[model samples]
Target: MDDLGVTVSAGSYRSTDPEAVHFPHRWSDEGVAVQAAFTGAHLLHLSAAGCVLNDVYREAQRLGVAVAGVRVSATGDFDTDTWVSRGITYSVEVDSPAGADDVAGVLEAVDQVAEIPRAIRAGATVRRVPAAGQE
Candidate 1:
């Protein structure tokens, strides 16, 4: 039921599902570590939150901080009947030796670079075009 798809110029594609379309990519590729989703709003929510959390973890690691665990959940006021999300909220929990100050910084950092989360929070325009010689 997803109408959107992604084309990565050549190597691989992560398209709408339940087709589960995935292409083989070399383990050495940067994308090997970054998975994409085309599963609509909820998947977007998860991806956005995850992206922020990943960044936080990366920065924490660089700072020599140990984060034992991290969990993120998204809740929203969405109208399925209207096919729109009215409001969304993200909740995060982290088990770490980093104090409240550091955790607060992580949260702030999430605000700065969670692209997908920001996309959901601020709606976007999406268009679909026919592939290659299709009509």
Candidate 2:
């Protein structure tokens, strides 16, 4: 089993600062669109996109294919009425010296094993643990 962890702290809604926390890895919108910044639905799509991009390159290397560049766009629809993610769609463009069939094969292999999408598709349970000092 593969395990990964990340922590996102709440940011001040009234702050002028870009990020709520000073952590190096924190993502901010320059204090604009704070609500969207913290929305889990948006972050979920981003995570899936990031996973696909990383896996593309990794799989390319493993397949001995030289990829000049890669771009992935992922979008998910959220049903506010039901508070659920309805579906997700993604498109990938890869610049490579390998033949089209080879590149396609690589992409398929990556899709099969990319972590985030797999977890989401498999319905992984999220267990929230309170902070150490929390009651």
Candidate 2 regions with alpha-carbon error over 4 angstroms: 1-38
Give one digit per residue, the lDDT tens place, for model 1 in 1-135: 332222221112222344333344332132212233545665655566556556656666666666655555554545669977666566666667779888777777767767776776677787899998996
Off by over 4 Å in 1: 1-39, 62-64
Per-residue lDDT over 13-129 for candidate 2, one digit per residue giving the tens place of the 0 to 100 score: 222345533322222222212212445766787677667766876788898887766656677776667867776666677777789999999899999999999999988898989
Query: Local error of candidate 1 at 2, Å?
Result: 19
Q: What TM-score does candidate 2 get on C-alpha atoms?
A: 0.70
TM-score of each: 0.61, 0.70
TM-score of 1: 0.61
Residue pairs in collision within model 2:
none
